[model samples]
Target chain A: QQQVKQSPQSLIVQKGGISIINCAYENTAFDYFPWYQQFPGKGPALLIAIRPDVSEKKEGRFTISFNKSAKQFSLHIMDSQPGDSATYFCAATVWGNTGKLIFGQGTTLQVKP
Target chain B: GAGVSQTPSNKVTEKGKYVELRCDPISGHTALYWYRQSLGQGPEFLIYFQGTGAADDSGLPNDRFFAVRPEGSVSTLKIQRTERGDSAVYLCASSLNGRSSYEQYFGPGTRLTVT
Candidate 1:
């Protein structure tokens, strides 16, 4: 069973538009929700994260909106740019999880000018 | 500060050959993790190290796979007998703590191919 699930296997957005990627998880014990961005031939990099206590978190142009009751979270990119094109993965982990993380399949995001 | 670094960015070996992948975590990061990613798929957890010990290796597939972190800084993932099924990009990540809230920094990854 997939503990965490990500949707929109692929997405295409116009530059300067809002790009959104969504994820849902089955484990309620998961307290940490994080999103990672990965470029071709490069390792995954932390983009933004949120805890169940907070409904939203924003850093620069990246934002993570979380809904605990719904068991869902989404990543919003304001003013999406071409450079933002890459693979985005959402992950969840329960506290005291022994450093184990459950990751979603992934979504390939593309921004066109 | 330098991020995590991995050696042998790409490795191609024959079936039944032995291969070793190396990982150098960020300085002062005590927790290390290894994951495998196949084409068009999400990364799968493999093993984790807390300090010099393998705190959690439940993700390891079988006896053919082994990893060691003797100094709590560098880790080596060894496969005694390589199989085509082992072909995937091996990723290394490190975190400041083994706790769940910490974010992990990943290396470029070592692409392994067995034929």
Candidate 2:
């Protein structure tokens, strides 16, 4: 029940296109969902996050669409650029639970030039 | 300001050897966490520290894995009788507090290769 499953193990999109990655979880206790971006030989960096209270949250070119009933969320990158090419992970954790994160399998996004 | 910093960018050890990885979180950050990421996978939580005490350690895989934050500033992850399966990138992160509202800043991570 602690697992956050992500889909599309790998994706390739051209520059100026939109890139989407999906994730689902079974734990309803999770109230905070965050997406991280990682580059080769680097640690994962926080990209954006959302709460179940809102259906969607947008930050700059990155948007997180969340569905509380389905226990699913997705990350969308508008105008995908080569710099956005990296491994993306979706994670969930319960609020006020010491912030222990359960992460997805990760999706490798490749933005073609 | 510096982000979380980890020492020994890479370490190679033989099976049964013990190793220690260190982490220095951002100044004044009160929450620290440890995670391990295997090849092509996301990081798996290992432990969390709020101040000098471990708040959550259920994610630790086994007794061979232990972490300590003696001074509430620097932290260390110790692995005993390491096996080849222990090879992975060990990550350390910290936030202002253990609250979900605060952002957790991550370190570059230390790669451990057990042969």
Candidate 3:
């Protein structure tokens, strides 16, 4: 069973436009939600993360909006650039589960300049 | 500081062959995790080690797959009598502890291809 589900397997946006990706989870036990960006041939890097206590978090141009009641979270990238083109994965984990993450299917994002 | 490192970035083996993948986590990190990712799919949890002991290994596909972190720093994922379906990129991650707030640092991953 896929505990975390992500929509839009792929996305395309013009340069300087806003890019959004969404993810949903069914496990209420999840407390930490994080987003990872992965380039080809490299490891996934931490993009942004949010705890259930916060409704939203913003860092630079990346923002994570979390809805605790809906069990959903979304990532928004303002001024999306071509360099931002990569695969994005959303993950969820509980507090004491050895930090093992349950990841979404992933979304391939492309920003055209 | 160096991030997580994985050896043998790529490996190709014939079916029924045995193989091992290695991962060296960050210094001083006591929590380590292993995951497998297939083509066009997200990473799947395989096993987790907290200090020399496996804290969670329920994600392992079967008995043929096993992992060990003897010293709590380096981990080895072993596959016996490998099948073609075992082909995928094996990823290793580590954090300061198994706490929820700590973010995991992932390695480049080892791509295993079984013919």
Specify the highest-lDDT model's number.
2
State which docking tier applies to candidate 3: medium
Predictions' DockQ, in order = 0.78, 0.82, 0.80
How well is each residue in B1-115 modelled by candidate 2, as lDDT tens digits? 9999999999999999999999999999999999999999999999999999999999999999999999999999999999999999999999998874447889999999999
Question: After TM-score superposition, what is the CA distance of residue B38 in candidate 2 from its true location, in Å?
Answer: 0.4
Task: Give the alpha carbon lDDT tens digit for every residue of B1-103 in model 1.
Answer: 8999999999999999999999999999989999999998778899999999998998899999999999889999999899999999999999998874378
Q: What's the candidate order when arranged by decreasing TM-score?
A: 2, 3, 1
> Of the true interface contacts, what fraction does each candidate have?
0.84, 0.86, 0.82
- Encode model 1's per-residue lDDT on A8-89: one tens digit a residue: 8999999999999999998888888889999999999999888899999999999999998899999999999999999999
TM-score per candidate, in order?
A: 0.97, 0.99, 0.98
lDDT of 3 by residue, B1-115 (tens): 8999999999999999999999999999999999999999889999999999999999999999999999889999999999999999999999989874368999999999999
Candidate 3 stretches greater than 4 Å from native: none
lDDT of 1 at B108: 98
Q: List the residue pairs that clash in candidate 1.
A: none
| Cα lDDT tens digits for candidate 3, A40-93 | 998888899999999999999999999999999999999999999999999998
Is candidate 2 or 3 superior in TM-score? 2
lDDT per residue as tens, model 2, A9-70: 99999999999999999999999999999999888999999989899999999999999889
